[model samples]
Target: MSDVLLFSAGLDSFPAWHYLDKPPALYFDLGHRYRDQERAAITALVDRCGIEVSVSRELDLSRWEADNAIIPLRNVYLAMLAANRAERIWCVGVKGDATADKSPQAFRQISQMITDLSGRPVWLDSPFWQMTKTEIVAWYLGQGLPAGNLLLTFSCSRTDSAATHCGRCSSCLRRWISLVNNGIDAPFETDPWTWARVADYYVPAMRDGTYPDHRAEEFFAALDAVGFVPPPPAHPATAEDGQR
Candidate 1:
């Protein structure tokens, strides 16, 4: 059985392709709001790298995460679809992710469900599950590949071009945190630190240890590089404020 990645041409999955020794990749065009941008980014990357990846069309999973940035059961849908291509499926999730559908426990459960239903051995996993996005980016650049190509990867909540990211969005903020921590300052239409969430939410939340320590360390370091500072530790944002 072959290994297939549920590729999205984003920060996480793009590096995952390399970490997995360049496995065959599968991208689903869910016709979401950012599909056009995502498809374009993927096309650019694959064409540049000559990667063995293909797109599956017309599977519209739009509006699932339109209002809120979190895509509900997104990994579940992707895992099930990927099983059709390979009994061994690779879905890239990062450290500190215990999302309902993207955690290690969740992946094991998906694998069991798929195996039982198909009566065929199926296993879904994320090699980067234990690695934070910053660590993953460092690993990717450490591969000695041309770093410029990584700029082609897309991670934006709103529409973004291959060259510029909308810095205000959570996806953009996350991407900036990872890339900046790796000393790769990507192009953003607005400085990610200027995204009000950095001051109003993330700063305090990260300081209070609402996020994993490793992640918080990287997050603060990235912001510090850009001259952003958090409030006093005593005034940390409560975890109940939620991750926005």
Candidate 2:
């Protein structure tokens, strides 16, 4: 039986492709926003690792128009789509440390709905579901994958062709801080934006009694443990500068 990946060509999913015991046979593309870095990274990953892909199945939603990171039930819809195409295990790279609010519970809820709707058993696998970014990166490094390409995977929610990563956005900021915490300069150093806005946004939440008590605490604590002093703010040349 073949496996399918809800592949976004992001840092989380890329290593999932590499690390799955039964390597993925198809990549379910939601046709949301596209980034050149993601495209390039996927192409390179497929070539280097010999994974197959199925692309461009549209998610018929009112185009994601808002900046709010949470899109209502996006993963659930995507998981259902993947289930239709493959009956075997369907893997998602929902990292435990990264996806604090939306990992196991979200996935379990979706799987239950899919079984009810489709009337079949399908496995929703998340090998890295309980692992931290540090653990994932260490796994990748141990596997002898090139660290250079790791930076090419895109995680930015805001898409810009010219500056594919809106470095100021929450997603980009988290990725940047994650890289810094890992003691590695983010691959997008040439981009004009810095993690100052990201740090500013969270540090206050952390200092005040506003931050959530659970995974959010672990998230911020990990950043603090990693010594991610936010840099001074700088505007990117364009929103797409570091995107991909």
Give TM per candidate.
Answer: 0.91, 0.74
* Count of steric clashes across candidates, in order: 0, 8
Pairs of colliding residues, candidate 2: 37-244, 162-240, 163-239, 163-240, 163-241, 164-240, 164-243, 165-243
Candidate 1: stretches off by over 4 Å: 159-163, 233-244
Decoy 2 TM-score against native: 0.74
lDDT leader: 1
For model 2, how big is the CA root-mean-square deviation? 9.3
Model 2 bad stretches (over 4 Å): 35-37, 88-101, 189-193, 208-244
Could you give candidate 1's per-residue lDDT for residues 34-151 as a string of tens digits?
7788888898998899878888974667767646556788888888888887889998888888878888999999999999999999999999977998888889889897778889
